[model samples]
Target: MMNRARITRVGALAAASALAIGGLTACQSGGGESSGGDVTITWWHNSTSDPLKSLWADVASEFEADHPGVTVKVEGYQNEELQRTLIPNALRSGGGVDLFQAWGGGEIKDQVAAGYVKDISDAAADTIEAVGPVVSGWQVDGKTYGLPFQYGIEGFWYNTDLFAEAGIDAPPTTLDELYTAIDKLKAAGITPIAVGAGDKWPAAHYWYNFALKSCSPDTLKEAQSQLVFDDPCFVEAGELLQEFIDSEPFQDGFLATSAQQGAGSSAGMLATGKAAMELMGHWNPGVMGGILKDDAGQDDATPPEFLGWFNFPGIDGTAGDPTAALGGGDGFACAQWAPDECVELLEYIESEDVQSRFGEIGAGIPVLPAAASSITDPNLQQVLEGLQSASYVQLWLDTAYGPTVGGAMNDGIVALFGGQGTPEDIVKAMQDAAATL
Candidate 1:
């Protein structure tokens, strides 16, 4: 996630909003290739923050040290700019990027269809096998295209201290209960929620959760492949989101707030104790820490002691499984023209040792099962527990829906948040966008 503006691999809820970071400079460079036994692998990812950023840099240097005559150039960019603009443009323009951020789902599908990404099924087989079924998001027709390093489910990241102050003894389990908590927070003069509506996806996730609760698992699965919005549950999802917004729980001028900037972003609001909670992905703690550190210009800052989490509240009457979850993870894909070392680098990144450190860093939930013990953070471990206990996990809606439809759907949801659109309008937007495909 661009410093907290743009992303999901449901670690998807991990980053900030892409739209919120308008000045994400594109540091475009050609895929590094040299003759005479010399190789350079250029890697791009959406991690412009600590722990993950330094970790990737160190990994690149380590890889270079391991292989003679090999130089790896690794870089980080804001999530949205890299995913939505830089990466795609680089792929289409050809040869500008080698290894880069890949958020599976429809984005990778479209890339594969356009002959932009390499078929890594045969190349990174062991890494693919190690990550197991989570790799499916990066696959199309049973062929692997990208690999995930961190995978997790979405939930509300709240301030436990604020909960106490508001007299919310326990996190809510149902929609009505969540409303009660919100009302209680308000009674205590606290902003119950912080949403980066300025960044569309953060706000859109409310609808994603609503849809995850409203639609049956099979219907969501079908929608992923068909892009059809005929199901009434989809409409119901929007209605629920509308009702939640009508409750006026978010901080003032939330529509202008970014996701991961400094102290003013939605994540920032939660980080600074200015708001009670935020709905975000597994990478939230790291994002919050990064925001606080950047704000203070410090070497490190950790998630506050008051931070807490709970899965999205269920709607009792909904067709979807109450235990079902919404999620995604950050991943990597090599450009079609990238050299074989690109695959080698991908493998190294997902290697047990590297991924163990990934888990240890508390940046996000490591995807490899063997590295599970490395996840020492209590909160991140809780996310792992949620991922394990989920009756089913739905990939983030925009991601599962792919770029065209997903982009349209996100825009429509954000429009709803801004009071300019309706639930049915989101369905129509998805349909129109899907029609073009």
Candidate 2:
């Protein structure tokens, strides 16, 4: 197994800059370097650990085998580090980075506008055909620039034992019922929802999903493209989300907990019967699995039995359908200055074989439906089924909005949780931000 921490060794092929050693002359080939028969292509990503990193290496090796004599130098960075330093630095023309990953939306779209990335429509035609409409999510300006690679949808995770103990018959299917369920769980001395407001992004998720549930996909799409924030749908969504937070369903001190701390704490609470539910993504299975395994010693190690999930229920009589989903995920974006070898590398990654391998390694859900059939992991299968049930899918609010829109939503959410803002106050802030955008 490839340890994710060893990415610098196996993932990175080029250092900060290329060097010219004495008498070891090298010419710039299609991907970047040409020495003998080696075609070194610079590939960058943000997945730096665990099964996700391991799966990527397996795919890279397969790609190498498919194209004899071509070696992909897969470089990786930690999520925050990549966004803050590596990506900005790589944007300089001729930086030796041919391909990299980005959270698809304004960030990548802005890159497209700046001419920093390539339009891979023709190169990815076959992939689009094989991957189906799911690939369209990454398209911009009538051009397909990247592949919808690894992805997972967001939803609510709950403790099955807690539900049974509270005499809850089923997971809530509507907001009213959801609150009722929460009340029942609270009476049993368990927090109904576990929220980590400390990490601004996690707090942002609640507001984002609430907006998605109240708005139509087309309206949200328009808002994303134009950076519009004041759309009535947004106000309605913000208000809905604020009400949930105000219900006092989250555990005490949730407002003070950081996202990192909240994730483990929330899962721990569920496992030890401290909380009944958590809003999370499919990737959480691995975290939950690791925690459960560690809690049980050696031969006695087994996953907790109470773990399960449900989509965040929809608001009744709202414009949004009950089946709409909110999601955020990673995808590849080609540098506009990329050489042929770099483009070829992307084509290879999008192929059915590579997509199928993604599932086998347990790296969340593969974006391609055909690839979903090959995932042998039962838990991932459950996740895929849940995703397929959605009537519509909305990009995560932060990824879908400009920094201003996202920031306002994040601040409004934190303020609401801290008891310093009202539903009207939050909605007004969102509307004001959208108006400026």
Candidate 3:
């Protein structure tokens, strides 16, 4: 359980902070002269933190150094804002930026359909062979549009200290044991788990994880594509999700809390020994290390260590293994309206050396296996191990559903949490939405 903030949560008007974090040296207005080459590319991102900033900047520098005539003007956008306005502006005015980051699933499809994103299938195919899973997940309509810049394996992140205090030997490995452990933690006067349902995406994680464990990878993929919510597997998954939420294991005020607040609360709970576990991603290390340390005014030289993780366990009777993971990340995208120079810049961002440098900063798991192996960080190694062993990887539910229907799923989950709806009702709602899409 790491006490950290996600850059993706930063609102749209907060783009100034995002850009500053990128550390772009060159400023290019609509008609600025390039230092050497006549080509200048505009790059946009959604990262405002160190590793992501350093990782992307490293790639940009490499791109400029290698291609003497081209320069990259990078801008950072809040993830939420980027989807809201930047996309429309890109499609209409085409002045937003030449390249931006995008999630691979339904968002990619929607953007491509809107005529805002370029078709990089031909450009990405050969390179994807080298990058593997990073690129594999980005493909749509038999074509690829972007290269994966980052990846995180989805699973439960737990607190070892809390586990020991509760006399729980290890993280649960099956559905029954999972419930038993939650009850044990509850008996010990601790919240069994910390969750954020304020943002539907986080709540959807549970449902999707259940779907992942309940069905074959192919079925999940089809469900994502056809928007088939009525599938028995998904219904079963929804029922399980309701069971967890309806039970008294979750922390108080969970439904009333916002995503950011819940994350901070969860981190605090774990860091201070109040909770046993949380379900989160790899990006948490920086958050917990930075925010919680300062809150206590402890010596800057040494910070408390209170972090650990485990993969999401499988349902006992499910065909999928516990090691099965959900994998997806943001990526640099080439705008269809962008000039060739911009496309070139994006291609460089995916290069081996550049990607390796990104890994050095721990911004993300390098999509290229070779580059990922070059990273020496132990936590990153843990994430890499999770990805490498995953029998099958499921993409984020929001990513898979695209925006419109995904939003609906989120609402349904929130409603489920308030006891206003049933799991079958929620699943049917999503399935109905899927049928139209």
Question: Each prediction's Cα lDDT score?
Answer: 0.87, 0.70, 0.68
User: What lDDT tens digits, residue by residue, belong to model 2 across residues 1-437?
Assistant: 22345456324424533331222333333333543476766788876544566567776787788778777778666554576446755674346577788677766776777777788888767776776666655778878877768677888878888898988998887888999998898888777887667666777788778878777777777777766555677777767876777688888887666432222556555655677887887766554554444442323223356677788887877777678788766788777766666667777777677778777766578877777877866656766776788777787777677566677877887887777877667767766888885
Most accurate candidate by TM-score: 1
lDDT of 1: 0.87
lDDT string, candidate 1, 122-192, tens digits: 98888899899999888989999899999999999999999999999999988899999999999999999
Whole-model lDDT, model 3: 0.68
TM-score of 1: 0.92
- The C-alpha stretches of model 1 lying farther than 4 A from their native spots are 1-36, 297-299
What lDDT score goes with residue 116 in model 2?
75
Supply candidate 1's per-residue lDDT for 283.
Answer: 91
Q: What TM-score does candidate 3 get on C-alpha atoms?
A: 0.83
What TM-score number comes out for model 2?
0.81
Number of clashing residue pairs in every model? 14, 5, 4
What candidate 3 gets wrong by more than 4 Å, as runs, is 1-40, 58-71, 121-126, 260-274, 293-304, 319-322
Model 3 Cα lDDT, one tens digit per residue, 1-437 = 42234334354346744764776333323532334547777787876434465557767777778778777777655455666556554555545577887778887777778776778776656676777756755666767788877788866667777777778897787777888888778877878887666555666678778878877777777878677765677677778888877676777877754433322556555555556776766665544443344454434312125566677777877755567798688787787766666656766677777778777755557777678766666666877898888877778887778877777777887787778887777776776777676
